[model samples]
Target: MSEIRTYADNRQPLDRNWLHKQWRHLRLWRRFLLQAVVRETHYRAHFATTLLVGLVQLGLGIVPILLLFGFTQEVHGWSRAEVITLVGAYQIITGLMAAFVAPNLQRMTEYIAEGELDGVLLRPVSSQLYLTLRWINVAELSNVASGIAVLVIGLVQSGASPNVPQLLQAFVLAVCGLALLSTVWSAMSFLAFWLQSVNPIGFIYLNLVEAGRYPLVFFPVPVRAFLTFAFPVAFATTYPVQALAGDLGWTPVAGGIALSVVAVTLVRMLWRRGLRSYASASS
Candidate 1:
């Protein structure tokens, strides 16, 4: 008979076959975030320049949203400030994707084409994690800051008195939604392992994500339904706006968190499956 075993602090036996330990992996990501902060400091001038340009574009993007309030009380069922929140949320997530996963994945594909992936695979840590964070666009931090400021301004302009819980609810949902969105991008990029010519596909996916610039409600029913269920983007773009706009109740708010967890799970599984075909020059 097989014997049961368990770790001291853990209630159940440690599943050794799991390949990656999620708790430890998550801690590492937190550490990586800190490392990114320190790294950002070294490139102050470049980061500042990038931030300036991004902020200019982001500020310009706010015009249409603010104008909607002047021309009409609401835009596509969302009031002005609610629309601002939507834009802010979309900007935050999009900037994160561009400044992190997109660059690295683009480079990864180039490296694979040039037979440079061997160096990545030879590292001591997991190749997946290493490949995912090969480069960081420090300027994107400005986008996060600007997004939060916009959200606050949105609440003030909308005359919404969001209590601590409401504020926390919005913040937490936005972060999780971004995580899941990035994971999905990473998962999609890992398809390069098989597809070999996935750069075009990546561009297409990026274009699809651009559609998130507006609230999902503005979309036709079929598009809204597909993005919500098929692409899981409605959680990323619309739910936070809904929470602030008072269109959706707590159910969709909770659903965003649940969707994030499921998204990360699916991405990791897909990544592992692709890893099987990993054959490097050195190997």
Candidate 2:
């Protein structure tokens, strides 16, 4: 009877090939995402309240920009509408993080701290994918919707309607920029392996992102360079808007793609090293 139970509990090993393993992880992530959706759907009033709060936060973000423009036509050569477009782009990216990435990071930290990470590590898939894609904050969709609305209004008001190719280019760059930012978030969460608490570090990233709400022109040249190369603040918000507004050039676009690729590679290496350092509760 014990032998029969052991046989029943044992599962087949997964394919060892890289591509096959990745495909399996992809399917696993889809399942995790579906579970998250179902769980979120069960809390309707909570979802609604969260959505309303997100919208209110977005509204509050724009107020300072409006007040700044009231005192000047262009702050550092960025007109009111242009700055609005930047704000919308900022919201869209941050909203995406809040919906998909932030929740996972928070949960991952908990898993690490509580020594529940063994369950995640034992899965026959990429631990990074499982950790990052396990949860989705659907309520944050409100910020996404509001951001698109504001972005369209700003673009129309800016009097620059990008051609189809230009729009496509902007989208590709925006996605690359998002990838870069996700690496930053992943690296921040990796801190849990070493630090006992990382709540304050999470807030610091948000404050850094907040700086992207205005034109990069407002910042000093050194600070602008730091954002562009050392970090990716300009690529995340400014470059995408520049692409859509017909101001983007090829050189910076190439730079953003390169930065994203390098950042992602480094993040993967760091995550693996961190996992090795983790001592699970079961151990």
**For this target, which candidate reaches the highest lDDT against the unseen true structure?**
2
Clashing pairs in 2: none
In candidate 2, stretches whose alpha carbon ends up further than 4 angstroms from where it belongs are 1-13
Task: Give stretches of model 1 more than 4 Å off.
Answer: 1-42, 67-70, 281-283
**Model 1, TM vs. native:** 0.79
**What local lDDT score does residue 180 receive in model 2, on the 0 to 100 scale?**
85
Cα displacement (angstroms), candidate 2, residue 76, comes to: 3.0
Candidate 2 per-residue C-alpha lDDT over 168-249 given as tens digits, one digit per residue, 9 for 90 to 100 = 7788778887888888878888888888566777887888888878777889999998877766778878988989988777
Range of the 10 consecutive residues with the lowest summed lDDT in candidate 2 = 1-10
Leading candidate by TM-score: 2
